[model samples]
Target: MIIGVALGMMAALLAAVEVTATVRPDVVIGLVIGVPGVLGMLMILMSSRRWVTAVGAMILAIGPGWFGALTAIQVASGV
Candidate 1:
């Protein structure tokens, strides 16, 4: 539960850091896209109940999660 959320957040941060180091992305992009993305993932991972997960997932899907995911994808795809 809590552990999962913590791990997810850490993973997101680490991935973001790696991307930042490798890609040298703009500072704004890292904050705007990376931070929220990781935080959204944390929110989603923190969900222990079904309803909570649903809400978190929705929040993630709405924007932040995609931002985070896209940031990662950008690195992977070399875009």
Candidate 2:
């Protein structure tokens, strides 16, 4: 749960920053629409039982992490 939340927060920051200057519309759209839902789902799953909560958080984290990574790459490469 901790790891998931940490990673998710980190990714969200990256995505948010990327959204500010990124030319890719999809990246902006995904971060705008998908991230909040994923984070909300992660928060909701915090109340679930043991393994379920952990799995849920991780799953939610991974989804947006990819877009964040892509955006980060674009920012890094100045593409």
Candidate 3:
């Protein structure tokens, strides 16, 4: 549970940094950081662990996952 929480916090912090970094320039680098952030968030949610941790991860992932999925959709659609 503690490990899960730590991962969730790390994922959230990574996403925050990615979002801030990508605000205007160096989009590719920002996306690179964000991809792992989103993946880590999903990993936390998908793994069968303590229910409390799972719920915490779910909450932690929502923002980053939403933005990442939205970007993925746009990029794929553009291609």
Candidate 4:
């Protein structure tokens, strides 16, 4: 839980910085997706309830999973 919170906070901070400084839209988007994903993944890890796990998994897929896919595509395409 602590680790998850820390990672989420860090991602938020990074997004804030990107918004204020570079303002690169794509990076900001990825960070936005990642923050909640980290928390959702943490919740999934810590919970035993099936519904909670399912919700977390959905959030995880939409958030960091998509973010990772985008990043990989960008890297592969040299963009």
Candidate 5:
């Protein structure tokens, strides 16, 4: 559960960085998205409990869009 949370957080940060780098080519989106995703998948793969693996997969699937909505809200409110 803890590893899932950490990976989810890392994924969120990577996604945010990817969005930020869209206007600037200096930042590499592939690297940002790939590394954490790979680590998260590895962690999920290593989990012995099926529930843990499911939760991690779900978190990886959902965390990005949820954080993206929050980020959108913040940007809209500022504008």
Candidate 6:
């Protein structure tokens, strides 16, 4: 769990850096998706209860989906 948390934090940081470095909206979108995924994973690792872990996993899955959908809408709308 500790290892998972560490990896998740590291990945989130990396994704944040990537998002900052790029201008292409798609890569930014991906980074946006990734950051929350990592954070959710970290939450799962930190929590002791199975229910909390399950909720975290659900958040992890949903965050990226929201990001992707928002990105697609933005692209389609030329935002």
- lDDT winner: 6
Q: How do the residues 1-79 of candidate 4 rate in per-residue lDDT, one tens digit apiece?
A: 3433344455544544454454575666756686677877897998889988876766565554444444554577686
Report the C-alpha displacement of residue 37, candidate 3, in angstroms. Answer: 14
Worst 10 residues of 3 by lDDT: 20-29
Candidate 5 lDDT tens digits, 1-79: 4454455566656655576543342233344445546655876988899886776575554444444444564587683
Q: If scored against the real structure, what TM-score would every candidate get? A: 0.37, 0.42, 0.29, 0.44, 0.38, 0.49
lDDT of each: 0.57, 0.62, 0.53, 0.60, 0.56, 0.63
Error of 1 at 3 (Å): 27
Lowest lDDT 10-residue stretch of candidate 5: 21-30
Per TM-score, the best of the predicted structures is: 6
Q: What RMSD value applies to candidate 4?
A: 9.4
lDDT of 2 by residue, 16-37 (tens): 5665663567766576448656
- How far in Å is the alpha carbon of 18 misplaced in model 6? 24
Off by over 4 Å in 3: 1-54
Write the residue-wise lDDT of candidate 1 on 4-65 in tens digits: 34444555566666755554457645665556466668877887888777656544443444
How would you encode candidate 6's per-residue C-alpha lDDT over 1-79 as one tens digit per residue? 3444444455545554455453686675666667668878897999999988976776576554555455455577687
lDDT of 5 at 26: 25
Deviating ranges (above 4 Å) for candidate 2:
1-24, 31-48
TM-score of 3: 0.29
* Candidates sorted by TM-score, best first: 6, 4, 2, 5, 1, 3
Error of 6 at 62 (Å): 2.4
Tell me model 2's lDDT, rounded to 2 decimals: 0.62
